[model samples]
Every structure is written in structure tokens, then in C-alpha cells.
Target: MSCWDTIADYGLRSLGYGERLLPRSDFTLCQQVVLIGSGMLWNIYFGTLALIAGFVMATAVAMGKAARNPVIAKISAWFIFIFRGSPLFIQFFFAYFLFLSLKNAVPFFTVLTSAWAGALVVLFLNTAAYSGEIFYGALQSVPKGEAEAADAYGFGGWKKFRKITWPTMLRLAWPAYTNEAIFLFHATTLVFFSGFPAQSQRGDALYYANYFADKTFNPFVPYPVLAGYFILLTLVIIGLFGLINRRLNRHLPQERRSRMQMRMPVLR
Candidate 1:
């Protein structure tokens, strides 16, 4: 079959619409790309939803930690520290079990049993903690000069923060936020590995890729396919973030604004 045919036959296989079963024999490059690309839908679903949800929560946590009150600040600080300090793998496992146990106390909350809900929740919190720290750091690093300028313009409290502090934090943290986003996309692979089972084998890209490798006993094909897909996804993310960073910096003279740069995340 042509690559297009393979894709047409299996592109929506994860949702069980095309081909009742995945290709069991005669694996071709077309089949690998089609199947893995199909599986990427789930990864994108999780990553995109979690990212949108996480950013709002992250900003709140960062602002809370940056607050003047010691009580709220300390709690937010501990939250960021603990989540950032722990391995995401462990967090997934722990979250899955905690959700499982929740069945006893709240049987109606069955959403926790599914990867869509359970995994997304964990991912949201995980990204929030990481992003929270980045925002907090940016908050601290917001220049005193900006605040002084805002004061001269009679912008104080809510006005000062709205006009300056928030935007500056976003700009400073954009690069790190990009890294967080890339890692979160990659991290979606761990959903099936953790306690949340892949119902009907409807798994993420890594999950199906692993399936193909094990069935054929050839890691070379499926693994590289996954890596390529993820790399491409990362590039798309880079471009999107770059666009946003440019818009964020649009107000400044070209020299005064920092250039957006990519850095490999050491933590991940």
C-alpha cells in the first residue's frame, strides 16, 4: 500500500474506527508512521488540554507564592518545591493509586479511573508546579526599574501588576515554559505505564510504538518513528511559542527585549 493508503486505513485506529486490529504482520515504514502518527492524537489531546488547564493554575500558584503574606507564600513554596523535587514517574504512580483509593470514598467520581481524567489531572498539577517555579523566578526577577516607571505613571497595586509585572513574568518564563511544554508532551507517554490502564489498547504514541517493537522484536523501527514524531511535535511547539514570545516583546525596542532562546531541560 502507499503511505497514504496505510494512513487512510489506520489513521483513526486508536479510536477503533479503522481496521479492527493493528497490523500484526508485514510491517512497513508506511504502517509504522501511520500507526504512530495516529496514536499521537491522544498525546496531543492530553498535552494540549493539560497545558491550557495548567497555565492558569500555575500562574495562581506563582502569584500566591510571590505574595506578601507568609502563610500563603510558605504553602505555595512547599507545593512547588515538592512537586519539582520529585520524579514525574513517581508522581504518576502515586497519583494513580490515590485516585484508585478515591473510589472507596467517592464512587461517583469515576473520571479518576480513566486516563483522560486521572492522567490529565496529574499532568496538570505536575506542569503547574514546574511552571509555577518558573513564574515565581520571573516574578522576582522583574526589574525594580519597571516598578519605578509604573509608579511614576501612577500605576500601583493591581494596576502596576496588570500593566507590567504579569507581562514581564510571562516574557521571562516563556523559554522555560516552552521546555516545560515539550517535556509534558513527552511525559504523556507515562500515562499508560502508570496505574491507569489503556482501555482497549487505546494508548499514546509510546505505548503503541512499544507494542509494535515487542510484536516484531525490532526496536529500531518503531522507536525511531516515535522519536521523529515527537521531535517534529517539539519543533511545532517551538514555532508556536516563538510567535507568542515575539508578540509579548512587541512593545519593546528590539535591543531592550531579550531574544527567545531554546535550552535543553536538565531536570527532565
Candidate 2:
């Protein structure tokens, strides 16, 4: 089939649209590109939803960690430690089984056994813990002068936090948070390796890439294509986050604004 035909046939195969059967032989470059690109939809789905939901949870957890109540603080601290301290791969394995057990016990959890729901939960919690720590650090680092200034203006409680503390904390945490966002997107690939199965042959970009690699016994082509897709995704994330970072620092002089520098963690 022509490239356009390949696109039409496999463009959304990962979402269970178009052709159901994967190409078995005489694999063309167009097929690999299109199918893998199709699978990227899942990665984007997992990353986008997880990151958005995780942000809200992270903010709350950060506040909890920094709360005056020792009970709240310790609970938040343990939550972060449990998620952050463990390898994500292990988390996925255990979560799948746990959800599977729950599904058997409670029909309501049936959906949670699927990769779409189960894997998303894992990613959500993982990112939240990491980001909660980042936000907590930023909260702690919020200049004491800022708090004093808020007190001087008679800004207290939620109002003060909304107008003064929260915005400043975000401004301080955004650079690190951007990196976390990038890493979260990258981590979506792990879903393919998780215990959660891709139902109906619908899987992520890495899934299709691995298929092509196994079929052709040529790892070079499909793997590099997968990498290329992720590289483009990383660029998009950086550009978007950079705009937000700039918005956060807009009130400050250009030289005084905190610039976002990409720092890949040596180990997660």
C-alpha cells in the first residue's frame, strides 16, 4: 500500500480504529512510521492526563507536607516517600496485581484492571509524589520576605496564600516542575512493559516499535523512529513549559527571572 493508504489504515490502529491486523511481512517504512505514530496517541493520553491530575494532587500533597499539623505532615511525607523511593517498574507490577485482585472482589474495579485506567493511576501517583516534593521544596524556599510583605499588607490565610504564597511558590518550583513534566511523558513508555496488557492490540509507541523490531529482527529502524517521536514530544513539552515559565516570571526583570534549564536526572 502507498504511504497515504498506510496512514489511513493504521493512523489510529492503536486506538482500535481502522485495520485490526498488524502487518506481518514486507514491512515498509511508511507502515512502521504510521503505526508507531498511531501508538504515540496512547503515550500522549497517559502523559497528558496523568500530568494534569498529578499537578493538583501534588500541590495539595505539598501543602500537606508543609502543614502545621504533624499528623497531616507525616502522612504526606510517607505518601511521597513510598511512591518516590520505589522503582516505578515495580510499582506497575504490584499495582496491576492489586487492581486485578480488587477487580475480582469488586466489579466496580473491573475498569481499573485495564492499562488505560490502571496504568494511568500508577503514573498519576508517581508524578504526584515527585512533584509534591518539588513543590514542598519551593514552598520552603519561598522567601521569608515575601511572607512578611504579605503580613504587612494584612493578607492572611487562603487569601494570602492565593495572592502571594501560591504564585511565588509556583514561580520558584516551575523550572524543576518542567523537568518533571518531561520525565513524566518519557515514563509513559513504561506502560508497555507494565503488567497491564494492551487490549485489542492497541498499545503505545514503544509497543508498535517493539513489534516491528521483533518481526523484522532489525532493531535499528523502528527503535530510532520511536526515539525520534519522543524527541519531538520532548521539544513540544519544553516549548509549552517555557511559555508558562516566562509567564510566571513576567513581573520580574529579564535578568532576574529564573530561566528554565533542562537537567536530566542521573537516576530516578
Candidate 3:
């Protein structure tokens, strides 16, 4: 088929549109690019939802870890320890089976065996733990002066946290959180490989790329294209996060504003 025809056929293939059957032989570059790009829809879907849900959950988790109440603190600490201590690949496998095992007892959980709900839940919780640690460390690092000032102004409890503490923690955490997001997006590639089956051949970019490589026994073409796609994806994430970082630190003087480094932050 012509390149345009190939594009048309596989462009939306990942979403169950156009060609249902992927190319079996004589794989073309256009076909690889088109199909893999289409498959990126899954990665974007998983990553976007996970990141959004994880952010809110992470905020709560950070607060829990920092709370004075021992029960809340221990619960949060255990959550962070469990998720952060374990490899995410293992988490996906364990979560899929755990969901499947409970499906009979909890009919609502039956859906968790699929990549849609099950995989999203795993990604959501996994990212939330990672992001929670970053936010927790940031919360602890919030300047002491700010806390005393809040007390002086009678800003106590949630008011102090809402008015002064939260913003500063976010400002400090933004850089590390950016890295966490990028990593989480990259982590989406692991779902199909873990226990979650891509029903209807609906999979992510890495899935299609892996298929092409396996079919042709040529890792050269498909893998590099996947890498390029991810590179572009990483750049876009950085750009979006950069905008947020600027806004987070916008109140600070220009000299005091910290520049975001591409490197990972020191989590401890």
C-alpha cells in the first residue's frame, strides 16, 4: 500500500478504527510509524489519567505523612514505603492478580483484570506514591520562617497549610514532580508487558513496536522510532511542566527563582 494508504489504515488503528489486522509481513516504515503513533494513544490515555488522579491523591498522602497524628502518619508512611519500595513492574503484576482473585467476591472489581481499569488503578496508585514522597520531602523542607510567620499571623492548622504551606511545598516539589511525571508516562509502557492483557490488540506504543521487532527480527527500525516518539513526548511534558514551574515560583524575585534542571531531584 502507498504511504498515505498505510497511514490512513493504521493511523487510528490503536483506537479500533481503520485496519483491524496489523501488517503481518513486508513491514514498511510508514506502517511502523503510523501504527506505533496510533498506539501512543494508550500511553497518553494512561499517563494523563494517572498523573491527574495521582496528583490529587499525592497531595493528600503528603499531608498524611506530615500530619502530627501517629495513625495518619504511619498509614501514609506505610503506603509510601510499600509502593515506593517495590518495583512498579511487580506492582502491575501483583495488582492484576489481586484484582482477579477478588473479582468473585467483589463483582465490581472484575473490570480490574483488563488494561483499562486495572492498569489505570495500578498506575494511579504507583505514581501517587512516588509523587507523594516528593511532596512530603518538599513539605518538610518548607522554610521554618514561613511556619513561624503563619503562627504570628494566627494562621493555624488547615489555614496555615492552605494559605502558606501548600504553595511553598508545591514550589519546592515542582521540579521533582516534573521528573516523576515523565517517569510515570514512560512507565505506562510496562502495563501490557506486566499481567494486563491488551484485549482487542489495543496496546500502547511500545506494544506495537515490540510486535514489529518480533515479526521482522529487526530491532533497528521499530525501537528507534519508539525512542523518537518518547523523546518528543518527554519534551512536551517538560515544556508543560516548565510553564507550571514558572507560575509556581512567579511570586519570588527573579534572582530568587530557581531554574529547573533536567536531572532528577534528590528524593531524600
Tell me the TM-score of each prediction against the true structure.
Answer: 0.95, 0.98, 0.96
lDDT of each: 0.88, 0.93, 0.92
Task: Tell me which of candidates 1 and 2 scores higher on TM-score.
Answer: 2
Cα lDDT tens digits for candidate 1, 57-147: 9999999999899999999999998889888889888888887788789996578878889889889998999899989999999999988
Q: Who is ahead in lDDT, 2 or 3?
A: 2
Residue lDDT tens for model 2, 163-206: 99999999989878888988898899999788999888899999
CA shift at 80, candidate 3, in angstroms?
Answer: 0.5
Whole-model lDDT, candidate 2? 0.93
The digit string of per-residue lDDT tens for model 3 on 42-149 reads 999999999999999999999999989999999999999999999889999999899989998989988888898899998999889999999999999999999999
Off by over 4 Å in 3: 265-268
Regions more than 4 Å wrong, model 1: 1-3
Number of clashing pairs per prediction, in order: 0, 0, 0
Please give the range of 10 consecutive residues that has the lowest summed lDDT in model 1.
259-268
Name the best candidate (by lDDT).
2
**Model 3 alpha-carbon miss at residue 128, Å:** 0.9
- In TM-score terms, candidate 3 sits at 0.96
